[model samples]
Every structure is written in structure tokens, then in C-alpha cells.
Target: MSSGALTAFILRSPVFAGLLCFFVCAGPCPGREDDQARVLYARAQKLLSEGDPDEALDRYLTLLKKHPRTEWSALSLWDMYRIYIHQDSPEPAFEVLNRLIVEQPGHFEKAHAAQLQLVQRILGSGKEARTNLESVKKKKPLPPEIVVEMLKTVIKNGPHSEVGIQAHYYLAIAREQAGEKTEAIAAHEDFAETYSSHELADDAGYQSAYIAYKSWKSMRSTGPHQRENAAVALAWFIARFPESDKAAQARSCLAEVRAAELSELLGLARYYEARSNPKAALIYYQQIASRFPEVIQTDEVLRDKILSLKGAEEVVGPVR
Candidate 1:
């Protein structure tokens, strides 16, 4: 608007005065802006309560646009989201939520709380009204992006918070289900390390180690690298949570990984020997013997072959 018309409008309407405050003394007039926001919000609430939802929505939209950075904008966006959803306008409802989530950087707690309410409403509750485990147990979880946003808000608020800890664990789960195992592992490990005293700490730590282990174990063509990853993951879980209920399972998985690795090394050694490269064969055999002495000693035939290669390597010398 022209400066003249704008000034006239600002003078004519008390609500429009707040909009001009932004133009005249934006950063310096927080008190004015906040007070004006409350006025607008009260006006919107009265309109809504009087059954003039359309007018209430307009008031809220104006408040959001004029005082976007004020805390009242958060309430405005939330009310707008509710109104859109009540009207069955999915697109606008999503837009309002995105505005709260993405544009309003100051409302981390509000955003997270709103998301939880939305999730609870959409997914239907089980026996517990409040649970750290609800999202995972849902038959149809919210979309990955929504869960991610919720997690981000929770994390941004602070991991020491009760809700933040739950969010950290759930965020890893969401990433895992989205096939981002690397990110999932990192998130889970972070949660475990940062909240080692919490009740779910062991669960987080095991999941961190298990994601990579499970992937390697399930692969059709498990390479040496994959076996090594599996072994390391299982070993980590065993070390980190030695008293955990899952410790025995981790031990079993680690043994399987070791066995598979030993098999690969033995196969490589035989392949080298078949190629007339006894020097390379000796190296692999020695590695397998060194790494798996218990397993090798129980197999007399393999032990004898390693001894012979050692004898030959002593006479012929190492490959290098």
C-alpha cells in the first residue's frame, strides 16, 4: 500500500496498528507486537466461540502473517491446522503444520507436542495413554517425514528431556524402517551413549549394533567386509551391554560371524594354494590359525595343513 493509505488504515483499525509496528520499529517493539498478537488471538477465539469460524480463521491468518515471529503465531498456526482438519481440507491442514514445523523455529516444544497429539489422534491409542513405545507399535505409523520432523523438534529441544530421549530412540527406528541403516545406527548409538542411565539405554545400544549386524547376516552374498561388520557389531553389543538380556544372543551372533570369517579365510588360503601360490596360502592359513585357534585346534586336518605351510614358509620364506 501507499504510505498515506497505510498510515490511514493503521490509524483507523487498532488491529492494523500492530502490522505497522513491524514496519516502523520491527525488532525494537517486541512488547507491542506481542501485546497486539494477544489481542488478535483473543479476537479470533471469541469469533470461533461465537460460531464464526471463517472470521476467526481470517483473524488468525492475519495474526500469523503480521506477527509471524511472535509466540502467538504458533497458537494461530495450531488453530488454523485444527480448523483445516475439521473441514477435511488435508492439503491446507498439512500446509499449516508445515508452517509450524518449518517456519516457526521458536516453538520446538509446541511443535513436538502438536505432533504427538496429531499422531495419537490419527493412530488410535492402545492401553497406555502415554508411552515411549506407541509409535513403533502403531499398525500404520505416520509418514516418515512427519515422524522425522517430530524427532527433530524433540532433539532440538534437548536430549536430556524425557520426551527427547524417547524421540531419539524412535527417530532411529524411523530411519531404520526407511532403509537408512547408517543414520539409524548413528542415532541409536547417540541415544545410547548420551542416555546410558535411562531405562531404554540398553535397547538403544543393542539396536545400534544390531542394525548393521542384521543387514550383514541377511545378505545373500556376504562379503568379507560384511562379515567383519557383523562381528564388530556383535562384539560391540556384548561389550556395551554385558549384563543385558540380549547379551547371550549377541554372543551367538558373534560366534556365527567368526565362523563365517574363518571359512572365508580358509577358502582364500586354499584358492591361493591351488593357484601354486603357497606363499599367499601360508599367510591366510596363518591368519585363520591365529584368529581362531580354538576352532582350528579342534580340526586336526586343518591344523596339520597350517603346520606344513609354516614349515614350507620357513624354508621358502614369507611372500613379502
Candidate 2:
């Protein structure tokens, strides 16, 4: 048999398997043993080339057990790591690489570089979410909700570099687009609250207010809603940077939310008016006009109130 194949057969034997872990040999061997190891390695390469990863993995494991301190041991382990990673088995890759790092602290730089690459694969690649976010435009494409979770991983594990901040910002945007309003709101809150000095803070603030308003609108029917909360958040956005370009947008958002609130009260007032309860309607109209006089609806409420008073006077047959 060839040297590589002979190694594979020898290592498969029970006696060799048991002795392999601690076996130490020096120099190019005379015959059988040298032939055996070469044969094993060659067989493994063949399996790997043929896409028989399972068999390839088993052979590598056997090679490691037999020659844990061999010069090529790290190479074998790294190959196994690559195969597992290629299979999308990050957990196993993580486990193996983690062990390798622990056992070989000298490999720290290599391990960390590998981690960076892996993070890109698992988080930014969008493979897990099954999306082509890289090639897709924001307006033309929809973000899958999974992007949020992926961003979280990147933010947690990636270095605290520009890439990290970018990850956080993208995550916030992705969450916003996925209609995960609460998470999106919280993410922006986190960004705006903690990363106020970040270069992207202004953009984040504008997007936060937009998301807050959208979230508030969607959750309006829920008791103790967030419309007012959204206004408060907008106020913070404006107060933090009054000169910011986004400040005008934040102000507009605040105005729109107040207008919505006033509109709601106006609707309620009309409901009561239709039911012939002018007193309750007046209360609602007055509340809207008094509390939110700047809203356009305030003028509409005042007109309704004036007409209601005139109708009441006519119904009572002319007050003196």
C-alpha cells in the first residue's frame, strides 16, 4: 500500500488507536509506521477533496490522537475547523477553536482574526436569514427580522471599532424596518441614549423619532399608550442637539403626534355630538382646544362648539 493509505490502516487498528495519543517518534522512519501515517494523511486528503467530510473528519481526529504534538497537528486541526465552519456548524467551530486557543495561547492573534472572519460570516453575510441584503437596496428590499439578532451577535463579539458602531446602527435600522417596533424603539433608544457622541447619532435620533411615532400609531388602541412617550423621546432628540439638521424633523414628529392626539379627541367629541350629548362633546372639544391649541384641529373643535351652542339656543326657544 502507499505510505498514506498504510498509515490510515494502521491507525484504525485498536492497538495503534490506543497508543497513538502519546506516541513519539523521531526522524523519517524505516518502514511500516512512516508508511502508515503518510497513507492516513493521503486518504484524508482524498476524502476531503471528494466532499466526504464525515470520513475526512474522522481521519483528522485519528491523526490528532496519534500525533497530538506533531508539526502538522495544528494544520490538521485548522483543516477540521474549516470543514466544520464550511458546513455552517459554527457551534462546533467555536468549540474547537476555543479549545485551540486555550491550549495554545500563542495562537491568540490567529484565533482572533479567525473570529473576525467568522463573525462576518454569521452576522453580516445574511446567510442565516437567507437574504441578499448586501446586493439589495433598502427601498427595494425588505429587511428580515433575523437581522436584529445577527447584529446583536456582531455587536457583542466584534471589536469596538467603527465596524461595531456600524453594526449597532444597522441593527437598529433593520429592527425598525422589520416592523419590530418595540425592539426598534429600544434599539434606537439604546443608541441615542448611549452613543450620543457617535458620528451616526444624528441619523439615529431622526430614525428613532420616526420609529417612535410609527410605533405609537400602531399601538394607539392599547391602554396607556406610547404616543406621549414618543413625544417625550422626540423632545429629548431636539433638546440634545437643537442645531442638528434632524432637529427640524424631530420637531415635526412631535407636532404630528400632538396633532394625532388632538384628532383622536376631536373624533370622540364628534361621537358624543352625534349621540345628542352636547355637554360631553363640549368637554372633549374644550380639552382639545385648550391643551393643544396649536394643532389645526383646535379651530375645527371651536367651530363645532360654536355651532353646537347656536343649535342649543334654538332648541331652547331663544334665551333672553
Candidate 3:
């Protein structure tokens, strides 16, 4: 139809005019899509302001379907995510947020801000969560899965924020509580590496080393290799956090590991001595005297033992 005839038809039949506008104005109006999207977006926001989130969600979804490539669609998706979060449905919120992030990379900060808000809503204020964590020493006292999801969200969305740092710290605790020592250590390490300037960085490092130390210490038959790893971890903790409150404990742990190593060496020396292999026994005794003199039960006793072993080996012709 000619523009004039269409205008006349629109002017003559209001119902038809309304139907025409619904289909034409609401559909893809190439050059006018931006204006149309703005109008639709305003309507959705109005619905939301009027406490009709269900209707607002419908309008936002319709806006997306009609103007999928328009900038307004990205805005609509973000609003939809907010709606889902308000409705306590994180699954859809995450879905919409993922789409918004991918479709509008420049809007990543907006999406990240929105995700942080959602996480805060889910987990409450950071101070409150921290207080609860400090008070509760039980394993998985908070919902592990939900806390884990929040941690992932913050780490992925706002890794440099205070919330992200806190999430990383709490995730380590949660993983440890859940008996995931390896994952806990990794999380603590990641936090320490990524946020070295953060106040909790030293604590994160300590937790990582302490977890490894505890695992090895609790073993029924701790081998030299395990002892070595645990000692290295404790030593790292001591070096990294010399002034930290945990430093003393770390030193003590290091001392215990060294003592264990020395004990193992002495046991080996005694075993070889029982077998009448003075040369082999002497090697072990010398290892204790030279490599672990500090851990020897007594300096004089270790020296005497080393000398006795050496004399016995010489008498046996060095076991050759």
C-alpha cells in the first residue's frame, strides 16, 4: 500500500492500527530498531519498577527475540539476569549473564558488577560471612556447593576485588573442610600467587604449606620422600612468613621433620650394624653426623656413634 493509504487506514481503524503497530513497530525495523528497542526496554523497566517482574521478564525476553542484535538486547539480558537473581534462581541468572558477557565483551564490567551483587545477595555481607567462618570451625558448616559456586563466580568475574580475594580464601577453607586437601592446597596457592599484596596472602601461603605438612605428619609410615616434601613446605612457610604467627609452628614442624629424618637414618644404621655391614652402617651414621647434626639427640653421642661405626668398618676392611 502507498504510504498515504496506509496512513489513512491507520487513522481510520484504531484496532487495525494497533495490530499493525504491534507487528511492524515491534518487529525488525532496520533503521528504527534502536528507537523501538529503547521504547520496549523502557516498558520492561517500568514493569519492573511497578513490581511486576514476571511481566518485566516477558517484556525483556520479547525485546531480545525481536532485536537480538541490538545493543538494547544486551541490556535486556542483563536485566533478565537481575530478575532471575531477584527471583532466587541463579541458574537462569548465570545463563543470561554468560550470554551478556559473550555477546558484549565491552560490557564485561557491567556483567561482573552484576554478578558480584548477586553473590553478595546470596552469601550476605562479606563481614558477616567472615565472622561466621571465624566462629565455626566445623567442616562444611556452610553449604559447600553454593559457596563453591559463589567462589567460582567471584574468581571468574571479579578476581581482583575484595570479594574475590575473600572468596579464594574461603574456598580453600571449604575444600579443606570437605576433605579435599589437594584442592585446598591449590586454592590457597592460587590466592597467594594472584593476590600477593592482599593482607591474607601470607595466611594463604601458610595454609597451603600447613596442609601439606599435616598430611605427611599424619601418615602411619612417613617415608623420606614424604618427610622431604613436608619439610620443604614447612620451610617455605617459614621463609615466606617469618613474622607471621604461624612461623613458630612452621619452625617446629620443620624441626620435627628433620628429627624424623635423623631417626630414620639412625634406624638404618642400626639395621646395617645388626647385619654386620659396618661400612653401610658407617655411611648412615656419617649422614646423621654431617647432614643432620642439629637434629642429633646429643652432639657427643652422635660423634661417638660415628667414630665407632668408622672403626668397625676399618676392622672389617670396609666390607669389601
The digit string of per-residue lDDT tens for model 3 on 94-165 reads: 668767767788777667656555555445433222211113232323455665676586677667766556
The local lDDT score (0 to 100) that residue 291 gets in candidate 2 is 76
The TM-score-based order of candidates, best leading, equals 1, 3, 2
Q: Give the whole-model CA lDDT for all candidates, comma-separated.
A: 0.76, 0.67, 0.76
TM-score of 2: 0.53
lDDT value, residue 250 of candidate 3: 80
Off by over 4 Å in 2: 1-44, 62-78, 96-188, 199-224, 238-259, 276-279, 296-320
Alpha-carbon TM-score of each model against the true structure: 0.60, 0.53, 0.58
lDDT of predicted model 1: 0.76
Residue-level lDDT of model 1, residues 79-192, one tens digit each, is 887776565443456557667768887765666555544533433321223322113222444566665665566566565667666767777877776678899999888888
Q: Which tens-of-lDDT digit does each residue in 1-320 have in candidate 2? A: 99999999988888887777546644545465545656777788899888687898898788777765553456666777777766666656655665565555666557645644554454454333232112322222223555455556555644475656667777776776677777777787788777888877877877777776766777738322688888887887788778788888789888888777777887888898899877667678768767776653546657666566557756875324
Q: Which residue pairs come into collision in candidate 2?
A: 3-39, 4-38, 4-39, 4-40, 5-39, 6-36, 7-36, 7-37, 8-40
Cα TM-score of candidate 1: 0.60
Rate residue 138 of model 2 by lDDT: 23
lDDT of 3 at 228: 81
